[model samples]
Target: MSRLDITHERASYQAVFALDVITAAGALIFLGLASKPTFQRIKQRRFTAPNSKNNSARDGPLKTTLGTYLFLWPALLCLFIAYVCRLVSDLLKTAGTINYDDDLGWNGRRAYSTADSGYASNISALTFTTALATIFFTVLLNGGVWIHSSHVQENGTGISTPRTKSRIWNSAIMLAMLGTGLAAWGLGIHARDVSTGSSGPHALLSWSTVLQHHRATRIMYIVHEAIVVAASLSVSIEVLREYATTNRNARDSPERKDLLRFAFAVVPLIWLRDIFILYDVVLLYVDTAGWSATAVDATTLLLVVCRQLANLAILGMVLWGAWRMSRSVALFGRSYYA
Candidate 1:
């Protein structure tokens, strides 16, 4: 809105991507080690149970770990969203049908979205894909993790009934996700019609409806993040329960040491990532600051900085997870812990 030196934005993106490459490469190597025949044999032999004292027989062989599947689905979904976003921007640029100052008006409020500019089709498609991907990703990824981790905790600690029913929590999660997706698509349709200079039944969503969409999306994201944190806490409690009961003095065991490391390391990092991301999302909408250029610039700068910091923290978390996996491979060639 304040017409920032686009160069700064470009530089930040480049720097974050460079760090991501390193993180991705490190992760690939860690995953590669996991794929070795020797390690696979060892991993299958190790980590074959519910790590509880009461249920020694609950342990059995799993051909593959849950984390592997959980990570892959979300990654693919995010990649799809990013590709759609890029495609929308590239199509807009290539068509050269609208400039920021004219067609978009001041601060990117599209005063005129012409069909000739590809606003209706391309942007609508991108927005719909983004809505779908984010909704499905959050529901499947976090929901799945919470479910599996809860199962582990329940079986290990023998805590069958938590304070709340899983069904209620799951229903709330789905509702939040659905509301987010619907709001996004609704906002997108509103924008598309606005650009084409038509006031359909959808035009009931005035430009301010966009702000409402932003607010709804933000609130839903916070709720989802909190839900994930609660689920993660459940996992930690399960681990601690084991330590208190069976593995009270088994810190010498690599497996026991690994579990403790995970409770402290990965969980806190996950907490940090979620908090920073939530704050960044809030800062992003601060562009709606309206007339004050200084406020707009300040908010934008903070948003960018916070996002990069969050990205850095995410990479660090993944790198740490990879290192932990490597440690498991070294200590027990067939073990999979990450």
Candidate 2:
């Protein structure tokens, strides 16, 4: 590598490392904030009688929404894992624990070289975690909101029925499961890439590579993203429909509305990340040959920043929305309620 190339490569790695550190910290903060209400609710449930009159008025309707709060945690956890994997990948690569092969580079002396084995496996793990977080976070957030709104609506009318499990909710659930399965299957296919050796740059840490250079890996991610997009679109429509149909004068209407609005905010962020992923795949195929080291480095850092920040924003919204839902007027028996 020339002097300029060396400088660019070092700068790129440092920037990514710093980004991972910051993003991980943010994810931890969000996780802690989001879990506060969940833990408090758990404690309250332990101490209070489920049938007690005092608890009944406060907990009755909101208990139905507990699943919403609970569901948010797993998504947050998945995100945390995803970022942690990125951090670890960067650490190992920098530490020389993971071997990078130069011959696999499309651009001579690229920053993200193809890893031989262990590094490739780390990349696969990162993809798996990212896939899980991306697929399920959108699903759970919207699904929880849908289910909570359904219960709130049913409760308002004093009629609880199986119809609360509406077709839209069912479809969302099915799609989410299918997306997750595809992601796992993709990860499995990626294992083949890992063991046989990576064919292209392993920018999994930068969110700039998703096995796209490999035919099977490319198809896997495209299909997975499509499935997630479908699920998110359906749930978003349902949530919007509920928002319109919900009576403004109803007691829980504002809570439902606020939650739906949060969902609206999050879905677009998900799509934005999806778009970033697409750009990365395109970059790989178009060939980064003749691209300057600085250009490659800058591109990697840009994608990392955009994708991680989007994830942080999504987690923050979930924290706020879950906190609001848990502390709503209809739900009581927690310290906040007291």
Best model per lDDT = 2
Off by over 4 Å in 2: 1-9, 39-64, 97-210, 247-253, 256-264, 277-281, 290-298, 328-338
TM-score of each: 0.52, 0.67
- Cα lDDT tens digits, model 2, 166-211, are 7556665657556655664556444443423443454333222334
Candidate achieving the largest TM-score: 2
lDDT of 1 by residue, 1-338 (tens): 12212233344334433443443454344334334433454556543333433222224332223343344334434534543453344344334232222211111232222223324355445544644555554445444334433433333334442237565766575566556555655545545443234223332222322333444443554455555445545544544554454245433344344445545664565555456555544543544535465444444444434433333343334334333423344534355442
True-structure lDDT of candidate 1: 0.41
All models, RMSD in angstroms: 8.1, 6.7
> Looking at model 1, which ten-residue stretch has the lowest summed lDDT?
99-108
Off by over 4 Å in 1: 1-71, 87-116, 144-192, 195-253, 280-338
In candidate 1, list every pair of residues with a backbone clash: 42-334, 43-334, 43-335, 49-59, 113-195
